[model samples]
Target: MALLSYPRRHPSIHLLILSAYALFLLPILDGLELGGDGLYREILRDETVLRLKELGKVIAFSDEEGVRFQTTFLGSAAVAVQDVLKLNSLEGTANALGEVRYSPESVGSYVEVHIEQGPVLEALHYPLAAELVLTLETLCKEPNKFLTYDEECGCFTEESLAGLVCTVGELLTWPSASNVIPGQVNFTVDIRAMDDKVRETIVTSFSRLVLQRCDDRLVDCAVEQKHAAAATPCDAELTSRLERATRSTISSMAAGVRRAGGETPVLMSGAGHDAMAMARLTKVGMLFVRCRGGVSHSPEESVMDDDVWAAGLALVNFIDQNAVDAAAATAAESDVASGFARPHWSQAAHQFGCNRAP
Candidate 1:
């Protein structure tokens, strides 16, 4: 109840304060880091929001005369520290590292429309898939392991730890000379899985392996958890709506196009997105459009115009359907509350002498 209360006693604001914590509905309002795909993705989000607004209704109801509707969207303020450190010197960036002040509470549902960014949909011959979950992790080591003493060998051997590199990307060894024994090595690890348990197991094993190898060689090993994002799951009820929307709009595009029952699969996102951050606040879901060759973030990556249209239509349909269902349910509850319907247990109460005065 504390989470759902509106801040103001406005006449126009009718909040849905359910113990299930049904709150704001989120749509893909914007996209960040606009590579070529980013621009297209933003267009899709803007258009979907615009169409929903034109429907002349808001997802949440209000008792006030003129309440403005509000929906949550992902904000780009939570950029990685490693990325920010690259552009500007760390001198004036202390304030930037402070906690995020603007997270909304108890999100009802989230829907993001974007290019699939992977080859799964294309391989499956389906135009769309709901991204049910995401996985990500980060691993780190400090100081330097090369400086560690070897009692048996007695001499510094650089070739011994050559095969110990697990994460290959962005590895930097200290001392920028050909003749120097490398004293420090820093690298990053990124992984994704649909299941949180699976991701946890992988991270645990990886960390254990790194420490064991370092201990065996008598190297001082330190691991710093730079980032760890748990897998986010889509709400089943909303996911069902997405599936239906996809079938009605995307499946009906061409006649006799076999839209198999289980053909349009639900996928787990390997790449991280703002959805992962939003998951902390509320429920999240995603609609994926097929990407050509499953290629993304490259010049060769492409998406068909037809697929884009289908995605937009599906989004519009989902929003409309949700509004209608919500309004009907609200009206039904209002009627029951007004004493239009009799309780089935009323007769039983009377028989047991438990009936009270009206």
Candidate 2:
């Protein structure tokens, strides 16, 4: 399912969660089907093109020769979400696509429970992360710039650029043969940080420096931002409650076993998730479960059975506690409305969902 909503007495305070499975797959190619020679061709159906035009949207297919069409990792996930939620359509207009859309009156909060995709939790021997930040994906390309040079390191080596993690996850070079100078160099930079200002500064500085260097060398350079997201912080009250629930669950599990530290590390997730987008609609929070060797998106990725149990138990405890508190707060508000002397108490009912990394 793309999104699931659990409503309580107060519809405006209900929680909405985006499932991880719903955000895992990318968009499927339009006309290709199973068991056909045309499967290799990247083609869009005429009807699909007409549908896009009727919606006032443009559809452009790549002109690259001999390019095989393949589903992207998260492209289909976005489309599914949009279809389910009726997003991106003009407000107050009927949906011409003939798909049922779910529109909630209000969403008080969003909580995502997912596995930690990186090695940080494994390295620290922690089972969960209660905090996550933002992710920035950038692409830089230069036709004449050679990849075997020392100048490229200048952007990362600066002292002011510290605290930000940068990875060259994808690199492409023309003339794939060995012993030949690369005619074109293109690469992707994945930059992430807890501070948006720091992240933007690094991106700006890196792009500026690269452009200046390319200009000096008389080489054509282009820097394009593929994606960007602002840091999404968990609600303070919700985070505190989650931490308490996690600690209680851990303490209960460790009753017969020896444990080293009693503290759960608050880590900044370098990876992106649906929680980032859901933050636009409600207050967002996250719970991360540790994985084996910090490996993810690979066949080797694994999580301990005990950790999984603990995550579930912790979530149950959190929901139980939240429900009790919300009920009490609602009663208090009711008492006040009835002209009885009651202490002011208010709380929003939260919804939970799962969102995995792409």
| Candidate number achieving the greatest lDDT relative to the actual structure | 1
Expressed as tens digits, the lDDT of each residue in 169-194 for candidate 2 is 77999986699999999998877665
RMSD of 1: 16.2
Cα displacement (angstroms), candidate 2, residue 337, comes to 13
Model 2: how far is 144 from its true place, Å?
40
Once superposed on the true structure, which residue ranges of model 2 sit more than 4 Å away at CA?
1-105, 132-160, 254-257, 335-358
lDDT per residue, candidate 1, 199-304, as tens digits? 4655788889999999999998887765565666667777788888877665445532354555557765655554555565556677778878766545666887
TM-score of each: 0.60, 0.59
RMSD each, Å: 16.2, 13.8
In model 1, where do residues sit more than 4 Å from their true spots?
1-37, 54-107, 137-167, 176-181, 259-263, 336-358
